[model samples]
Target: MNRTFKVALAAGAATVALAACTNSSTDGTPTPATNGVASQTKSSSTTSGKPSNGDDLNISRFADKPCDLIKPDQLTALGNFRPGESSSAPLGPGCSWFGVDALKDTTFFVTLVTKGDNLESMAENAKSFPIFKRTTIAGREAYSADRTDGKASCSTAVSTSAKDAIFVQGRPPANGTGTADKSCQASEKVAAIVIGNLKG
Candidate 1:
């Protein structure tokens, strides 16, 4: 397969893997099993009585400057970091920021997927998430997934519109001592910042 196809496939597979980790009951609602494991519910098309259309935001504005989605100050708040790197992908534009010093080896990835085909693929993959939950960030419908194996990684998907979404994935520094929850929390923090900026 070609490089572009491979990247698209890899992105799709990541989404599917996240969906597969969701621990839900047959009815699609989140439930804690008898074993005491709690599952996050799959969100519907609407959230907080609001539609997931993301009409108030424009994702295209950031398509060419995904790296600028988060400001330098925000990166400093997240942790010591190097400059961001940019790339293009089938999904849209992508950016990555790495941690510095003690966190020098860790990185956070953000991407915008605007094509209808890509979003549809992600929507299908979202179904397999064992811990997908609806959330509101900057008054937009958002979903998040946690690593099932207790790793320091988190993924968040924000619905920019019916056919577009922003994907944020974060991993703790390879040599850092942060916990999985901390890593996910960091991901959420970054997602919140990104959504806030997009709303501007």
Candidate 2:
């Protein structure tokens, strides 16, 4: 946790700008549900084989403890970043993790946007989000964007509802140990897990 790493996203003539972000060792197990919400015993209700709806993933229940949104086992599966470290970003309240040891360059986050714009609106505006592309994650509507300001960031904005988006972001170490696409791949995996564990 004392070591420093780098992720290269050298800035230049670009149309995008990824927000600043900034995990890997939890040997116990997946964190249990807080706020008295029961953990899901069945497969992801939010991830059924079909598409997602506005009510698919509601994180309001986790507003007090955003880190609990992800289970540690799932985090372990995704390069095991350090345990959920809650943080604040331009999007909203969120948690971040950085891989330790050999998992360097592996960094990811889950941000809850209570008042942020949805993917469609963000794309349509083109002022705040200039490079948003429609996509899907675990049957949920999503959008992907990379940091154009150079900093190496890959983000998948999941539409919890047509009006709300959950920001799942990824970035390599600043030491150039990773790339935006690869980080994004990791972020997508995390997003899928989040969706899979969402309560019905």
Candidate 3:
């Protein structure tokens, strides 16, 4: 995805973030699943809905840019790339930089995905998670557009402590030009871990 897009948060903060994880395809069809997981069917379109507004939306936990949560061992670091700071080398696929402004204060967790990763794989390797749900974020009608094995390439917007936050997720196989079916699963895993680890 070479373009940048803005998404309006429920709190009315304007975020000029990345949009359409990848470029669009002619058919907009996802490449066949060669990863031994079942392919996902297209999801029906729906009108934007209301956010949970509390249970799943929290940002206070992450506002400070906790050094403790930056686990290099768990996530391979690609280093920071501030917008407009041009470089000669190509920023490889899946390379992203999370800034202080990118993370809302109440956000206790963040999740990233590359294509071909599945939800079951994450859940199996993760700490713990709750059952999946198809819900909205910041009043945008969204759904759990994942495959049966739980593979997708999408993001999550959650609210906690009466504040709004954005959790941008990336999943792989390139998916041609759309969100991966496993993205929903990745969101679930991320949310569960973040929620479970949060302390009052």
Instruction: Please state every model's RMSD to the true fold in angstroms.
Output: 8.3, 13.5, 14.3
Write candidate 1's Cα lDDT for 32-87 as tens digits. Answer: 22211122233352222334543756879888888999998888777766688776
Q: Each candidate's TM vs. the true structure?
A: 0.66, 0.64, 0.33
TM-score winner, 2 or 3: 2
- Model 2 residue 36 lDDT score: 13
lDDT of 3 by residue, 1-200 (tens): 22221122211111111211221345643222222211221211211123344455333344344322234532333222222111111101221333223332111124222222222222221212222344654343233332223332444433333212233333332233333444554454444444444432
Per-residue lDDT of 165-187 in model 2, one digit per residue for the tens? 56676666646656545666766
Task: Please give the ranking of all candidate structures by TM-score, highest first, separated by commas.
Answer: 1, 2, 3
Against the correct fold, how does model 2 do in TM-score? Answer: 0.64
lDDT order of candidates, top first: 1, 2, 3
lDDT of 3 at 17: 17
Predict model 2's lDDT versus the native: 0.52
Candidate 1: the clashing residue pairs are: 19-128, 19-129, 20-128, 21-130, 22-129, 22-130, 22-131, 23-130
Clashes of 2: 14
Q: Is candidate 2 or candidate 3 better by lDDT?
A: 2
The TM-score, computed over Cα atoms with residue i paired to residue i, of candidate 1 is: 0.66
Question: What's the lDDT of the predicted structure labeled candidate 1?
Answer: 0.59
